[model samples]
Target: MDKEFKLASQLLTLLDTEQRWFTLAEIEKNLGLSDKTIRKMVEEINKQLPSTMTIEVSRGKGIFLQRDGRSRTVSEVISSMFRETIFYRLMNLLFTNVGRFSVEELAGAMFMSTSSLKKLIVQLNNNDLKPYKLRITYSTPMVKGDELNIRYFYWKLYGDAYEFTGWPFTKINFDFINQLITNIENEKKIVYFINSKRRLSFLVAIVLERVTKGKSVKITEGGYPWEKGAFHLPVKALAKVLEESFSIELLKSEIYFMQSLFSLSQYHYYEGSEMTPMKEVELHKDKEEYQMGNRLLTLLAKVYPNIDVKERFTLEIYEFFDKLLIDNAIPEWMTISKSNLTTYVQKECQQIYQEVQTCMQKWHTAYPSVLYNDFHLTKLTLLVRSSLRYKSKKAFLVIGEEFSIRHYIANLIKKEIGDQLIINTSIMKGLTDEMVQQHHIDFVISNFPVALKTVPVVIISTIPSKRDLDNIRKELLL
Candidate 1:
């Protein structure tokens, strides 16, 4: 990732989220950027935005935005804030001056000296472009390696083109673009996520841009079993639209490129529907994704003995693994942070989180080449959360089987909780040792100490006091 974009994005986010004024010291504390750099970034941002959307400063109040209307959405603000950065301006130059352009011409367009332009290209080549084995063939300004990588780079760089709030590709027509997307979606019969539509449109823009540069992408081999049949109609329709729009026929490889991109796990999902939960995963008799999912899970069981979520959340796990296997975007696009998602999973599912770490270690032992990140952990935790949502706990209340008291305490517990807890009242006859073991009782809620060792026991008032119920609530979670 480019440092400039990162700095600008964080600055915009801090201002956007806080809304109220922030002193230079406060902003400096959060971002760790010097006051001079902050002022310069603010200046750069104001230059890109229209006059109506501006940041203002007061004598003692510090800095805040003065928007003409409602606060800008995060995406909208990011797109605009990064628009005139030296990085994107360079991007605009490279993508537009496709066929051939001189170093001087490019530098002039971006208002940069030729030497600075060279240094920037060198920086990009050594950092972001190095991993994909892609380079800016700068002598004549052409792309090297896979055209698909070039497209993905653009997706990460400026994001997809939007009517106003995003990167604007003036050459492409919105109506025509919509028609192509519609053709693909209608024939594929799969619904895209909310972000997919805009992203799909950008890929179309990518194709148009590359074709303008007399380039085409091809993925000749290693195609999945389900890709071709699923991709045919949409691919054909999109090809026709592009050809008609550009007055140029596409090479076969270009068509193959689109098909392969759609096949990537990032593009779509199984149509949203109710899938029945399972007690144990049944290996799919034919589906490859399901089979692969089960195989990984079988290996996972060796790492952690308690591996029920692998099967309990089979459909979710299957789709997740399938997507990760084919996802084409760089994992860098999704930052790995100490987020609420990860923290909640760690706090609520500590045992499972540890097991997942073990499973990941086992995976590395088997295949030492690939690296893992929090993106994988976050998704796994999401599956854990889904699996746990359907998990029902068994609880036995030892409140001395007095008819009135049991009924009253049961009613109170019912009002406090719900079907979440399956409660059975038992008399305080010193408790049965085998009962806890047989029924898989999560915890025993009793008024008197049961002196048990296997299952957790929480002592509570027979009358169900607020403090007692609170203690019971905390125990039930375990």
Candidate 2:
């Protein structure tokens, strides 16, 4: 077989035994196929394979190989789907990174004419699976010859025009822009800060303009860091706009320009700072940290969790912030960070114990005899505390029924300390999920421990029953 065909076959072989889907890029990397070769091979395979089998293309998403004997292959139906061109890939990269795009920026990224992009966008919109839609409109000064900077585009895109236009050229609606901004901001893959600034500036400007019009603005009582400019607009007008548009109540807080500066500095620091922290890691315990010390691990994992963290950290800080503020108290325009977020996370973890202890004490007072017992109270306290600050807090608790007491220890962990711990009792007659619907299990526990850590394995006699062992082994094959 040719190299690309050989690679495709190898990938199919690898996939045949498993019951999980993979993205196109992943398959290409694993099989060592260039984009062109892979697409050609996939097309050939589509014609050759049974009607049930074909390559599934998710435009702007990715590709997957699917086999369903029962259904006429959707891939076949969409087989005539236009092959993704270089521009498609380029546009996907840019648009997927930042939700909205200006003609200039889009042209720059694609290295194409602005007019060409606009034409392409029109064609793209007409496609059956038009994953992205483009909207373009320009606002000239009611006065002529006004210099149009980046802000001009921003204002136009998010200003009153958004509401009027539909399809190819719709007016910019702030609500839609807000939704787009929120979606892009939270996404892990795209971190386009420059575009983000443009988006945010528009939202801030709109909010500011309403307040200045002497309209009724509702400003919250407690101050915020970004409240100075917020006050420039009338409180009555602000409140009305916030309530109507965002359903948020405004709070009185001065903007922390210094903190913003620091955050910006830290962003740069994070980009270039590969320097390891001065901390020794006990490899015998959490061996994954041997390559990089604990200090580096903590920084890398927390700050850039998506790319860096092998383990996922459950952040309930947003929930905490939500509770701290009154309804709609914090606007999207406002951003805040702990003085030192890294240190803050560690300190907050430490404090969970005290917080839990306080709750337990409340339980003690409410039902004295039931909870007052020292053993129960202590166990509850430790469970709560340990759950928060547990070493490898981000990793799973792998429970193999070993005579070494580790299995029993994991059980004790659940019995003593609940909620914060997820005991993946996979070794205990673990009914292997063929297609482990990840949605069913807690992410913190459901991950394969072997992939999560690199600790040595001594497969002791205290292993789970043969059936359970077989099941775990089979699942590992996937």
Candidate 3:
């Protein structure tokens, strides 16, 4: 089951969405296999399926998954997801050590000859490790790179591993970590948004363990400068909890790191020490992260010189790309539910995908030690695609029988996809090519069937259905 898990995930991404009749040719195209090869993957997925969940196939229409009432469970499927052998062992060791162990200690513990360890380090460096900007210096024998990317790399190791029981859950004291999380949440008046909450707890546990080993992260570049401000209150509160639990006050840099966590996950922030949603939660843009973002964009711009990187959303996308490197928002729950969207992005946004692949390859040639997954490449591709359509007109015409109903459908579509799409209203109006081009509308949303010689039109219920929304998302994101 080597690439079997990947096959299951890629296939699931194709069929899971409402445009359910994903063609066999499409599957074969995206996954790079024949019909026979695809069927074998379906069989593998079926073995893991509960009675309520199964992939249903139609010879002419292609495939879709049928869920009988309850949601599909993938504990069987996800549990089997892992890479094999040397890379796995090396990564697991890195996660356990963080900064606690040196190269000599790691090599000795892995029971490998120094030469073998050197070769593996070289191999990893020569591959995807370049993006993390990290390398193994034999002199120090510790992984050294940008601190934020290193932390994200460590988190990704936990993410890529098969065990779903949140590794730190097994390695750390559950009650102690949970209480620390609760103390922060209550004092801050925030919801810890399950997955990220657990990630924060796990991080605290790692810090706690590292502290026990007398390991403390130094205040270096990449951390947001710690300041005594309104946000500092929560950080101070959290630091107090940690001090009580660990019997030591956290260093200034540690408090700065904690401030980042709160800002990123916060639902709202206090303005003038008063809780208000009107004032946006301020996310600190570290000087190093901004430079990293600019450097990456500059590289991509070198490859695609004609594309507009000056757009506000384009800059935002680079920041999004940077955050993906260090963000601790690793989802505790894993599924191929978004595989359809991810695969669609891969296929539809080929230009951006190729540009990113080239950018990564270019970096690899220079750095040679950055590790990344195909999934992240796909995610980054989506970010690039978002910039492609940034603030561009998305919905052209809304056709309906009457004024009230048409306006209502238009509003509903806006409510559902307002963030990703821009809908312009024209009721009882014939959507012509002239109108579409004039408005720069990408697609049409109509309660009635509307035809276009050059553009695509989607017919939907006046109120919009799941099928309607799904198809819209396909057009929007893919």
Candidate 4:
């Protein structure tokens, strides 16, 4: 056997007898090996060890062997190692599933020497993925060009946490597949994006068709598990998949945040869990005050250089911003004004005014524009008619500014509950107070003070804070 394997076996025997944690120095001295050898041995052993058996290194302490209680017997340990290796390998393969890699990186990741790993890689190319056996095309005379691109593609398509439980061994034909992906990019046939779920779903279906060949396909890491052959896998895998698929090109769109949030939410839902408060908070925090809004304002400034500063401007600009998020238009809006209201409409609007006008044309074709000169001056109570349009007896109305975070949260809740949700501006009307007292509203949410005593009220804003709510709650009780 190899000398390294022999030394590893001897070390394992000693550790079995010790039955306790051993310091690095102690292991080094016992084996009569240098620190480098010991470290290398540790890494090698980790790969060979069973999943049930973990080699842990404490912060100040040394290394110790702990039983996962699941790993027993040499075969079982070996199987676990292979499983983990397969998991990581599959993840890497999926990363390059988009296409681009060299045999060298694939060999290194599989922990096999170039020659041995190549054989295993041949199996990947020859052996079908079963139900869906994918045939990959490699560029001619592959030496080394941009295999990293393939790795990046897989990462974008899947995530780092992806696994190929369906396949054994980490060995994958990354070089050949990377070449295929590069071709796909050059062809510009594959439309990789987040918002156009319909288009993206179609593209994914096409990819699956080419690879799976009507075979049983499993997409682990956040996809619809019941999606016939596809499976909703994990979060980490999804993140990586998105990174590989979209690359830096996706950064140019305005709906980047929404697309990112959708991906992030999908990953969290699968890998983490639904209703994870911390994750939800983190998602919102990341989207807080994106520079896009300010950028829009800058563009607005250039187009309507001397537009009136009426609240009408704010409402008009807000409508334009709404379309930007909805349509996912990414232009040079980021470099425009990004400060506040003035910056958003006067500056950003000017830059993207043409794009906005173009989008408005399409929207107007589908639905007639609400003829209103002054959106702010319009009574909030009058908008209640729009809320009542939803086919629900009870409704939760959240009233706030367009930029208010509460508005987004309320929209989410409304979508989930399918309630007749009303979103009103900050201004109040005569009937607004009466509507509150009547409790006609299931929930009245306001970021500002209101005399309305209608159904229970919720004030959602950062300024007042929850502490302030306590006082308001008491006042309502009185």
Candidate 5:
């Protein structure tokens, strides 16, 4: 990330946390910047943001983020800033460039001084590109690295940064790519998830852009199993379409690489009307992802036995593991910013978060190559919590009104918390400890204050209001 992008992201993030206006002094204090710099950053960010969203300034009241249409997230705002950075523009240029270029030519294309462009390349080489062993050689200004690593680096960079919001490849037609993906789906008898289809389009566009520029992947090993499977047919068909569309032939290695990308977990599945790729997962039990899923489930059982690892949950875990493996293999450099999710999980359910962290640590110990981070922990914790089938809480409704009113109150409570609570109605006159004990009531909901010593009592209006439901939720921990 660029320094300006980081500063702009910080400003947007601070504003996103609250809806109220912040005085200039408050903004300066929070961002640790001078008032002048803060104003400049805000102005630049506003220029990048769409018409629907903007940071509005007031004469005396400071600044506020205004949203007249669909709200944009802080990350989205940051990505918009990211696209304008010299670093992003340079990388995007390199990914689509056909051959090596003179330093002057490249700098002129970015409208930057040659010396400044060289310094930027040095910064990228020392920081972002260091991990992937990719570096832009100053002599010719071309990215040099392992072919697969190069492709993975750009795919992750563009995917994380753009994310269907904009088309980075101006030369490639988006509609043509979508049509090609639709053709693949129709021929392969599979349906790509909507988001997955977009991601696939991005990957295909990257591959086409790179390969057409004479940058083709080199297959080191004998090729993946999917190359000879049913999936290869669509890849071959896709290759033919590309050859005809671009007037270029794809190398065999390029075709194999495309096939591997398409076969990645959760991209598409057999069109059996099933939502997940459970059938595909079962067919590859011997795969590392499958074994990792089983290991994770066992670890979850030992750590958090209360969670039910049912079939649906099991498939979800498998899919998650598969994605983890792919991420590990590629070693993406771009940050998939989900800090909001991490914070939410840590605050909402610390116990489950810690449990997931423990399981992830154990799994990492078993397979050191598969590293886990806060992002992975947050995702897995959410999955486990979502799959949990909570035991119902028993509640007794005590109404002192007429029978019809009592039933009406009961129905209202039911409508509010029927999914989590089993409500039993009783008249306040006859409600006693014996009845409460017989029903095993976990809590009591009454129209008036009740003196129940065994169970907690929640007082509500004749017709339960939002506050009443909130009180019930607090008492029952719903």
Candidate 6:
């Protein structure tokens, strides 16, 4: 994604998440964007969005996103924008072409001058393609890199840009791919999640396209030992179906690549339940990836004693490191933009981010070859945050007004921040410092000034406004 589209997508996502009108200052603070840029982005976004959706800006109230019942989601809107970019267009063109083309030919196809096309390739090679050790060759005007990296790059580009929004492979039969996946599921006695199925379909389509073009993967390093596990039969089944349907034969390395993807945690699992058996966990216990996951959990447990080291979380971490250790060319940057995600983690969850960074550093020291980056840190932070037992802060609401007024204020607070706080109500006459200490109140919310040194007090209107609630949130750090 380009800078403008990324910014527009960020703005749209922010608006979608809140689904409420925001002041100009609030938008500026959250997005770290100036007013002028924001206005331009909104204009461009509005032009691209369907008629049923728009970013509505008001002179006094600022801006908010408005969507009708038929409007597409934020992901779909971003995907549509991605399709308009030259990067997506170029990648799609190359995949479909699957062969060498002259710079003039490519430039003409994209309706651009050869000079401009060469400059774009230079930029991509220096930045986006640098991490993958991949680049668009100037002479052939095709993606030139390790076979694994080439396949992985296309998989990620297509997966991130299109996802479930639309199929990018126009020539490939979607039903045929679905049937292939179904046959594998039947043979393996397991079913893929809807998302996993879609992801597998993309991988299959990419493999078919590449294989048909004689672009085969060759495992030069210690190859993936697919036969050691339970995936060989499924791999054979997939190969047979591809050969039967597309009249193309997949090499051993191509089959192993498919096996590696299928075994990833993101792709599939046992049919009946989401849980992985403890016996299976023990089976991989001796593996370095499993041990690494164990060490990470142990280190994190010091900070978060209540962190749930359940089977699912443990399995995911194991599988993550497993992918990292494998020779397959999964990018260290992962799918999302590195800077954007890292910035989010740094701002929103600083402590978790710092701890995960420390853990990553330690892992890098242990295994110097596996390049861990912000993507790994962000993912581990999310996993740790999910496992934590978050305790809600207790709030005592003291109102000097009548029953209805107190009830109304309490209900308003509840509606805004009920999940993060334990709300307790009391009339002013019944409130005391002893009571506040006895209940261990984190903060006090009152209409009148409360003379309590034990806990911080927030003064609000008898009927609280949005500003009043916001103030309460600031005091409580909610």
lDDT for each residue of candidate 6 in 1-478, tens digit (9 for 90 to 100):
3667667777888898877898889889988999887887788889999988989988889999999856678788887888898888997898788566688999999999999999899998898888778888887778888877788788888877887667888879888898888887877667778878888889999998888888888753354446665576777778887899889988777777788777763544574645455655775776767777777777777666666778777777777677665533434224432545677776666766787788777766766766666766777787776666544788888888778877787888888855777788754345778888887888898888889877888888888876677566555443
Cα deviation of 331, candidate 3, in Å: 24
- Model 1 TM-score (2 dp): 0.66
Tens digit per residue, CA lDDT, model 5, 275-338 = 4456655755776677888988998887555577766788778767765654454444223323
* Ten-residue region with minimum lDDT total, candidate 6: 328-337
- The residue ranges of model 2 lying beyond 4 angstroms of the native Cα positions read 1-198, 208-216, 221-323, 326-478
lDDT of each candidate versus the true structure? 0.65, 0.37, 0.61, 0.39, 0.76, 0.76
In candidate 2, how many Å is residue 235 off?
Answer: 16
Stretch of 10 with least lDDT, candidate 5? 329-338
- In the order shown, the candidates' Cα RMSDs to the true structure are 8.5, 20.0, 11.4, 22.7, 7.1, 5.8
Worst 10 residues of 1 by lDDT: 328-337
Best by TM-score: 6
Cα lDDT of model 3 by residue, 112-145, tens digit: 8878888878867766576566776664466666
Error of 4 at 92 (Å): 3.4
Q: Please, what is the TM-score per model?
A: 0.66, 0.22, 0.52, 0.20, 0.70, 0.74
Candidate 4 lDDT score relative to the true structure: 0.39
* Model 4: lDDT of residue 87: 33
Candidate 2 residue lDDT tens string, 202-261: 545444433333222333444332333212333334344545665444433312321122
Evaluate model 3: give its lDDT: 0.61
Q: How far in Å is the alpha carbon of 187 misplaced in model 4?
A: 36
**Prediction 3 TM-score vs. true:** 0.52
Q: Name the regions of candidate 6 deviating beyond 4 angstroms.
A: 1-4, 21-45, 57-63, 187-189, 220-224, 230-232, 265-286, 327-342, 359-371, 390-478
Q: Supply every candidate's count of residue pairs whose N, Cα or C atoms clash at under 3 angstroms.
A: 0, 31, 13, 61, 0, 0
lDDT of 4 by residue, 1-478 (tens): 1356547656665665655888878888888998678777878888777566756766557777776544464433433343345434544453334334456665565676767655544554554221123333333112121222222233232321222212221333333333433333233223223233322232232233223322221222221112111111222233245447534121212123223222322111233224343433332222311233344445434433443434334333443333333222222122221222433343323323333454344433543422211121122112211122233334334445455665565555445434334444333355465655454555455555655554556665644443433333332222
